[model samples]
Target chain A: MGEVKNKQVILKDYITELFKESDMDIVEGAITLELPEGPNEVLLKNLYLSCDPYMRNRMNKILKIEGPATLLVGYVWGFTKWEEYSFVPSSRILFKIEHTDVPLSYYTGILGMPGITAYSGFFEVGLPKKGDKVYVSAASGAVGQLVGQFAKLSGCYVVGSAGSKDKFRFSVFVNTSKSFANNLILHASPPLHLNAYLSTTILQIRYFPEGIDIYFENVGGKTLNAVLLNMRINGRIVVCGMISQYQSAQPEGVTNLKKLITKRIRMQGFVVRDYYPMYPKYLEYVLTKIKEGDIVYVEDIVEGLENGPAALVGLFNGRNVGKQVLLVSRE
Target chain B: MGEVKNKQVILKDYITELFKESDMDIVEGAITLELPEGPNEVLLKNLYLSCDPYMRNRMNKILKIEGPATLLVGYVWGFTKWEEYSFVPSSRILFKIEHTDVPLSYYTGILGMPGITAYSGFFEVGLPKKGDKVYVSAASGAVGQLVGQFAKLSGCYVVGSAGSKDKFRFSVFVNTSKSFANNLILHASPPLHLNAYLSTTILQIRYFPEGIDIYFENVGGKTLNAVLLNMRINGRIVVCGMISQYQSAQPEGVTNLKKLITKRIRMQGFVVRDYYPMYPKYLEYVLTKIKEGDIVYVEDIVEGLENGPAALVGLFNGRNVGKQVLLVSRE
Candidate 1:
């Protein structure tokens, strides 16, 4: 009876396209049923597929694109074309999912890259002190949401920016309600709904009249310039991603950067993969916050694998309200 | 004999001008027959004068500049104008120089604004860590000389840039010969001599091949751009003066400031007067170094008060080799 039930299931796995437009190809392959023979390589079913702005770089052929996945390209010397699959040989890339009582989709959003990114970026790079005013760009997105919550926990005056009015309202509401780690997001400050472009500039001037001490910069270009002007002396800018200029043929020129000298600002760019050492501790803290209802986890889940194209493309346009994730399978 | 000596002295009192082009009016005043009864207001006969780049700001009748006496430009709000005979307003500008063991000329250079600027900027702001790379612009000048020495004492790799080839060689000689507490300027690289236009930029690049950990920036403009590009992660740039842009109609726009983001650079402009609390300690430490021959002091002593004008103006043109000090009442 068990063999019959297993055979009838016919497990369907999520497969991402190698190239876009006319060259797009999706692999129809069976899910690997092989279990871990040893301590290494825990077979993850990838129940919730993380759809990030950075992943857009991985979708195209490496030579033609640049971003987080370029990390893999540096090691992989030559690839003829993006045909069948992209495999990265690593001693460890997959980790066993322990203590999985909460929603599995949490792994794709808060519990994964986004969570650890906020953790390292806020503490290690941003260096947020108690009572510091922090401004996070793309506040409703995966990394941005967690960073805003973390700032609140760090005893900072946290103000966030999102593209749509709905997402901005939702983020403020979620944070104020203590959806993420019982940390208080100020209920006051009359609903900060701003256009993504004007929001980047106005939030800097309005929210940070004295100037922003820390900026978790996900969207770059004019946002960076505005932040540069609105930065306090010794302000810290953590360059998580430049999503705004990612699709452009040429990187946008930032003119007002000389303000860094007058303001004594410190800015740095980093990738979460570089800081894997803190992942275990980060996972423990984040998951605890989730289970205790101290940290609220939100995911804009696309129900099926077929909608991956629209969801992935929508990242640039700030379409997702929360972490844009695809529910591929149920473990 | 006392009366004859007093008459022979020709008590030449000076009054500083409120505007730049105004002559420093010298008044023929009678000498005091007896010492005035006062506690800490020992009358100092105008002896030697220090001409500095900072003093140019004081020459202009602009907004109230908040810095050393040399940099302060207002309506002679606190200071006795050029060639003006006046008593020190004890409460107004504190620490009126009393009986000094050293030459009163030292007050204008080593013991005055530039001296404290060097002491405060190098130790307090630069925060020279052991084995850190240090770069100083305007090496032969007052602040640059002391900063280089301080870096050496901190067990840092120090390199300095001067305008003249002679000054460059002299700094190298001083770096090697000095035995101050921190006199350990590592001769890992060649000394840099910069041209007027590309001076700051090329000097920054050459001095900090691995990128400067601390930059004592005296000349701003293209140099700032170079320093921005060549700064290591967490590098500190102390903007003491913007000599390059001081006379320009508009400040030269520095373009390469985007490097600050990637490098996590910190650039700060400071006035040495903010560090009055450490004056006594700085005086003691520097005097000790001078007395022990551990730190070598150099001055461009232009003889005759008539030559003072050329000496003072030479600073902006990079014509003055060392501290531009004029001999009035010579030893």
Candidate 2:
């Protein structure tokens, strides 16, 4: 078997708090070019690796899973290893890319995990009807952007919230007021009442004066508190991820949960891993939308497997503009 | 038309803080004891009044819904003038008491609002299965007792928590350690981490060490924080009420909300009103369960309409042992 150098990002140690680049080290490991002796295991040349906040929780030694090596012909955005080459079970590679007319790197985002997350969470959990008002937090991220687009495509009025002015600008279809973005930064660390500007009518009157029908929760903490107050009776909150709380030593307490009883709200938390069965159906719908140009995807790609640590760490800081991708190989 | 002295409990004014017996005035007003001129309006003598915590929120001016009235009923524990008699539309009355073979006052406890609250919250929202592990908060109160019984009837293992040692004794089938009940009071006001004892392994090991499959959330704030940490994957949290937070200036923050993502929990809030249609179906089921001694209900009945304020306020303080009912008239 021919051997090739596999450059990998190794965790230097278990992380208990906020993630740093120094927490990981670049290791030069060697991989056999051939697949392992099994009926299903395949060796793959990793192309696009996704940098997401969920990865932070799995860094704890208790939650670790072994990964790397597969002879896969196509691509996916599922878990493998943080390396240039990987050998893994064929089943571990979630969905094989069937439609290549779109960019292959799109596997890391809209055509992959984030895509199905938006699809199932919005339609299955949120159950939006026509003319419903939708609010999405972390609106320019991989999952949030798609949720906003899917809501818009379904004939719903959509409003979005993001941390920076740049994210509000980057999100083309989902509209959020610049003042709201400023307030997000301005009220980042204040007590909830002091953080009450967005939770009150000032933001509500401008965005959804009637109140929100669906709230897509990506960033938790203060934003969740505001959204809870702004939700209409029978509103649905689809909790996909809570990026804002990932870095904190202890996530801030959310105080407005009483609204859940008052409003008869249905707030559900979901993980995309349980929803892989929908990926084929999602691929069928999303591919058509992308080909027809009815939906658009924005990506911020960083080149090289060695830079994966920095790119992944940037997510909690909101440094990337869209679906953050690490380019490990081309062709 | 007949004129009679109708002793009424009138709000002194809108209350913005803790409720007191002084905030209500027992006024001797005159009632004609005749229905208003409408096809549906009717007049009737008042009997039992259910004193629960939800009325605390309705005391605010903004959420006001005019109440009191109705003629045609054997007995019911719905809203009415806290006086000797009432005149209102027949539609204003919720469910008419069809079965009075048990105590006529039961319409205020197991046969009325709290009955449906427990039934629907556990069966519909909770969706318990045989062999599942369930947890209930406020175990001796109106709703919690029935939820525990329903879980046991479904062949599931159940545990409950309440504010006082008396509540533990007052609840029937649900078994909770005395230590868990004590912690509910001990950690009542601490920060989430300092309040982490119950949220950690001590409570989990003693209770559902396998982790809770269903959590019936009656007392929110710190209790909800603890339950979230001890949930199994794919668990469901049916939030029927948040009694602990009713009197707080600002409700405490729950920090373990991240468990919602890690465990993929479905936390839902429901008001009892939406499930009223299920009342006929519920009444049928609960009646059979009660008659067979498959379930039992406890009532802490106080005499006089004048004592309503004390009974209502007692809910927040956990002074009452079971479902607190105010006996306006025994007939």
Best by TM-score: 2
On DockQ, the candidate that comes out on top is 2
RMSD of each: 9.3, 5.0
Give the distance in Å from residue B231's predicted Cα in candidate 1 to where it truly belongs: 3.9
CAPRI class assigned to model 2? medium
| DockQ of the candidate models in sequence | 0.14, 0.72
Tell me the TM-score of model 1: 0.66
Q: Candidate 1 chain B: minimum summed lDDT over ten consecutive residues — where?
A: B3-12
Model 2: per-residue lDDT, tens digit, A180-281?
A: 221222224333332254577434876778999999888788878888888899899998888777777778899999998878888888888788888888
Question: What is the per-residue lDDT of model 2 for residues B99-132, given as tens digits with 9 covering 90 to 100?
Answer: 8788876777677888889898999989999999
What's the TM-score of each model vs. the native?
0.66, 0.89
Please write out the lDDT profile of model 1 over residues A149-177, one tens digit for every residue.
88877778877765533344323323354
Model 2 TM-score on a 0 to 1 scale: 0.89
Best by lDDT: 2
Segments in model 2 whose C-alpha atoms lie over 4 Å from true places:
A32-41, A65-78, A89-91, A164-197, A201-203, B34-41, B65-77, B164-197
